[model samples]
Target: MSIKLPDSVPLHRGLIREFHDIRVSDVSSSFVSCQKEIYDTLMFFLESGIDYEDLCPLVKSNCDTYIQLLEQEEESQGFQTKFKTIKENYKEMTESCEVFDLDTMDRYAERDITAPQLSKLLKEANDGYIPKIKISITMVDRILRAFPYIWKDPKCILPDSLLGDGFNNDANEDEIEMAGGSIELTCPITTLIYEEPMISKKCQHTFDKSGLTEYLKNSDTNRYMEKDCAKDGCSKKISMDDFSPDTIMSLRCKIYQIKRNENNNNMKLEALDVL
Candidate 1:
């Protein structure tokens, strides 16, 4: 709420442009990383000989039914192909920002208002007003929804008359889906390593700084409400006002990068020695 902005409309325009660019980068990365994480998870399950499909149906039984989804994407030539991995398709989706209308947001006001807000701001660089799509409350919500599914087990994918959990009496614990996973030291929200980290004053939990800022700024209902900590099980209130730059975490992250590189080099050296 205490966002400081220069009154120059030209500056606001630059700021707004920067906001949109950063958002596209953030959102595109989220789309790729979330799918990549989920892909790795399922691949891990398959390699471990786990029957992921039987254990964790995309939908749980006793829930509302919906159509099952599988990747049926057509390539540039309009030929659907499975030769490319699912991760590659996710990358293709990111180029379009997953089919989201960022420009429509470029004109958004509050989510509750239906009118486009872009034209409301001065186009002549005479006022400091920033467009709502430039800040994108929609993006904040989209990122929030996209990241969580990476860790959740696919609910029963197709809940037809034959496959409902209630109808399937043979399902067992070994076949049931598990929650969350480990993928190195990555942000829970982005599923990537930390960049521009911020520590939550309330819970001491850390999140990518840009992600946290957006989360605090947007409300799904466009009404004031407190946000809980982003950590999976933590419930402490998180506010934009309570964040502090984390220099220690920054230094520690550098150390992590160096160590990871060193270990990678060592593995390469050992492989060469064997040859």
Candidate 2:
């Protein structure tokens, strides 16, 4: 017997459509996951490529920006907080002390007063018989000291990692052998080949011994006075005794000079052969 099919029966098409939708959703999810994976991988490679030298300036810039912002914010806050107090105090002091004008009073108040004098004036003011001028001077001194410029240490050095590996890894064994197996050496002071290398005990900056000695002799007014280190950004006071001969560095310089002379001779011979 033949069975009649239902008129609404598109069950095959519906099943196909449902399957297609599920597949599309799965594919989209997988594509998004793959894109994220690719981004993460790229970021990892980028981050890995940044060596200490590359990162140092960026870190310094960020620190400087942070400090500037903090200082500005503090200054704005301090001015706003102190302005009213100062104005009120000035008015009261001027009313009590008719002898001094605002400018004169301000100049006198801001002068460097000893700690003992400040304490005595504050105590006398507290006892209620002292003149208002003394109280105003103490207040001015406190305000000036409170907002004094903070001094940051100027001495900074690059870490060994940032200075790079002393050896030229890119040069093959043959090139290193030709160069007498000595890494490139330069004086920190003159940025030239080191001659009679001497290292500073305080900063460890290498310089030509004679050059450094000459510089010290010229810069120092007296033998007893401490000399500022010749290295850039190093403010450490170095005496004549703070320098020592760097024997290994001196040996490296000698080897480098020998290699350079050999290279020069070879170049001259090659030029004669070409002629």
Candidate 3:
């Protein structure tokens, strides 16, 4: 007699139930507070069988609805004012010919301007030419509070193994020691232990740099879609400028691979001796 496997719909319903149970709070507060929760819930749904491309429209609709609700609120007025101020200030700073010369333009084109360099330029622009200005905590808080509403639609959500808590959470020292102090690091994309790891500047997610580069180069669909991080629910857009060689992770992976090989060899030798 043949046995039938259960359909995924039931499993999906179960996960949805779990999601609602965990995040029962109304979505009336700061978008940041609920952003991670929404992303997590959506990721669960995606894993349960939802298509990534199809989910984009649903996500956009929900986000738009939430944004409309937020816009109708009294608090959003203050947020708008602060956003305008920052926008004006940034515009003024950028428009100054003295501040943005050929060298600055070249660096901007190369995406080589680091945080300190930008800070220094801002300081220079503000010191003599413009009135001394300080960005208040209220403004910063308001921007962060509204960011989730503005940046709601993610291009794609990849597998959980790629960009979720699984990648960020490290094993405890005790666990590491118990596991012979050898970590098994896998690339979320390749599902293999790390080889030539690269960290994303946008999300800090690590992947095999060469593998990612090749994937990006070859994938016309992803390139057209403006490929972002493949981590479970991360929406951070990525490009060649976003990756950096993760030498530390590479070294750790090498050590772990070597240790695992040695252990396997020793196990085989012991079994041979017994035989």
Among these predicted structures, which one has the highest lDDT? 3
* Candidate 3 segments exceeding 4 Å error: 1-184, 218-225
Q: All candidates' TM-scores?
A: 0.30, 0.32, 0.32
Among residues 3 or more apart in sequence or in different chains, the pairs in candidate 2 whose N, CA or C atoms overlap within 3 Å are: none
Residues 1-275, candidate 1, lDDT per residue (tens digit)? 55333222211323444534421112434434544454445334334533333424522321111111011111111121221222244334334332224443422222321322232322322243222221122322222222223324212211222222222324322322224422224556766777887766555566787677667665666543468877777768878766786433443354355445556777899999999
Name the TM-score of candidate 1: 0.30
lDDT score, residue 84, model 3? 46
**lDDT of all predictions, in order shown?**
0.41, 0.44, 0.47
Q: After best superposition, candidate 2 residue 79: deviation in angstroms?
A: 73
Residue 112 deviation, candidate 1, in Å? 95
For model 3, what is the error of residue 162's alpha carbon versus the real structure, in angstroms, after optimal superposition?
24
Clashes of 1: 13
* TM-score between model 2 and native: 0.32
Candidate 2 C-alpha lDDT tens digits along 37-152: 43344234224534433434543544354344434444444443444344345335433432333444443354421112223433444454322211111221221221111101
Runs of candidate 1 with Cα error greater than 4 angstroms are 1-184, 219-225
| CA RMSD per model (angstroms) | 26.5, 31.3, 29.9
lDDT of 3 by residue, 1-275 (tens): 75332211111233435533432233335544554455455335434444434555765665455445444443444444444444445445434423334545545444454112333433554453322222222322332333233323211222222222323433322222112323346777787777788877667677887668765664655452337677656677877677887544554454344445556777899999999
